[model samples]
Target: MTTPVLNTVLVRCSHTYQDELTVGDTKLLLDTTFRPEWHRKISAEVVAVPRKLNTRHTAYRGLKLGEIKAGDTIYFHYFGLTKENRLDTEDQDLYAIPYHEIFCKVREGVISALNGWALVEPVEVKSGSAWIGTDSEKISTQEGILRFIGHPKTDQPALNVQAGDRVVFSKNADFINTIEDKDYFIMQQEDLLATQPQKANEIESDYAGPRHYYETSPFYLSPDHD
Candidate 1:
C-alpha cells in the first residue's frame, strides 16, 4: 500500500514472453528458457496514485483518483522508464510513472488513448489496372482515419476531428502502438490537419508525374508564420 508522490502512479507490470528456443540437432539439443521482451511498452496494473501534489494516503477504497485508479489496467513505456524511478519487490516490480506518461487505460477490453494521444489507422492508397496480369501498387498518402481519441484535458479545447474522420498528416508522428494485434499510430492533437470528407478529394494540379506523397497544413492569417 504505497501512495505515490505527486501525480505519479505506482504500477506493477505484466510480463510477456516468447517461446523457448531449441538449439543443436537431435541428441545434442539444448532448450532455452522463455525470453522476456521487456523492451516494449507493456501493460500494468495500477497499484496506487497520489491525487495531489506531494500527497500520501493510508488506504484508498476504490483507489480511484481522477481518471486513474488503483486497480485499473494501463500501458506504459517500461524500457523508457528511468532507472531511478523503478522499485523492486519480492511479489512484483513496481514503477513510478509520471501522470502524463500513462499511454492509455484498458477498460473492459477496450483501450482509450490518453494524454492527448489519438489512435489512427493509416489509409492505404493503391493503384491497379484492370488488366489480368497487372500488379497493384501501394502509395504512401500520409493520411489516416481517426479512431479512438483520448480524454479531454482542462487546458486544451476539443479537437476539430472525431472518430471516423479522415485526416492528412505528415510521415510518422510518434512511436507506433499495437493493441490486440492491430497497429495504430499514436498521434498528438497538434499533428492532425483539418478533417476532410470521407470521399477522396481530387484537387487538380499540373505536376501529375507520380505524386506519391501527401502533405497537410492548417490555415493561418499571418503570412510570416512558418
Candidate 2:
C-alpha cells in the first residue's frame, strides 16, 4: 500500500508551451482531441476589474464573485509581455496588476485557468504550532531578499502568528533556479514578520516612522486629540 502523506500542500506547476499550443498542427490536435475533455473538467470565472485608465494609482474593484476556500494556494506565472508577440499596449499595461490581487477558482485539483495562473488547495497548519515542516534538505536566499529567523518559543508576542496566514519570505534564488519541481518551504513563525490580514481594518494602529512626518501627513491624525 502507498503511504499517505499528511499536511502536504500541492501547487499546480506552470506550463511552457502556451504560444505553440495556440497555433499550427498542435492547435489542430488539441482542438479535436484535448480541448473538449479539458473544458469539461474545468470552469473559469472572469474577474471584472478595470484594465487601463489615466490614473497614477491602480484601482482594485475586487473579485465580485466566486470564493477561495481555506486550503487554497495561489499560483502566479509571470511572463513579461510586449506588443510584438501577444499583448496590445493597453493590455500589456493591465498586467501591472499584482498577482495576489487576481482571484480564480479551482475545483477537485483541476486547474481552470489556461492563462497559466491558478490557485491550488492551501496547506492547513495546526494551531499553536510555529514551525512548518518541509521535505527540503536546505534553505536558500537571494541577494536583496530579506530572510528572518523565527524564535523557537513564543515568549515574544511580536512573532506570534496564526495558522493559515499568508506570509512573505525571501526565497533562495539559486535553489529556485536549479530545481524546477520543488515547491514550498519550511520556516518558523517568528521568522516571518508580516502576514496578509483578511481585512484592511485588522491592521494595528502603531506608527514606526518619524514623529514629525506622522503628525504632519494628512493621512495621519492623532487619536489623543479627538
Q: Using Cα atoms with residue i matched to residue i, what is each candidate's TM-score against the true structure?
A: 0.63, 0.17
- Worst 10-residue lDDT window for candidate 1 reads 206-215
For model 1 the local lDDT of residue 175 reads 47
List clashing residue pairs in candidate 1: none
TM-score, prediction 2: 0.17
Write the residue-wise lDDT of candidate 1 on 152-205 in tens digits. 554466787788887776555634555554556666666776777775433212
Cα error of candidate 1 at position 109, Å: 1.3
Give the Cα lDDT of each candidate. Answer: 0.56, 0.27
**Candidate 2: tens digits of C-alpha lDDT, residues 19-98:** 22322223322232333322221111222222322223332222122233323433232231212223233323222223
C-alpha RMSD of each candidate structure in angstroms:
14.2, 22.1
Q: Largest TM-score belongs to which candidate?
A: 1
TM-score of 1: 0.63
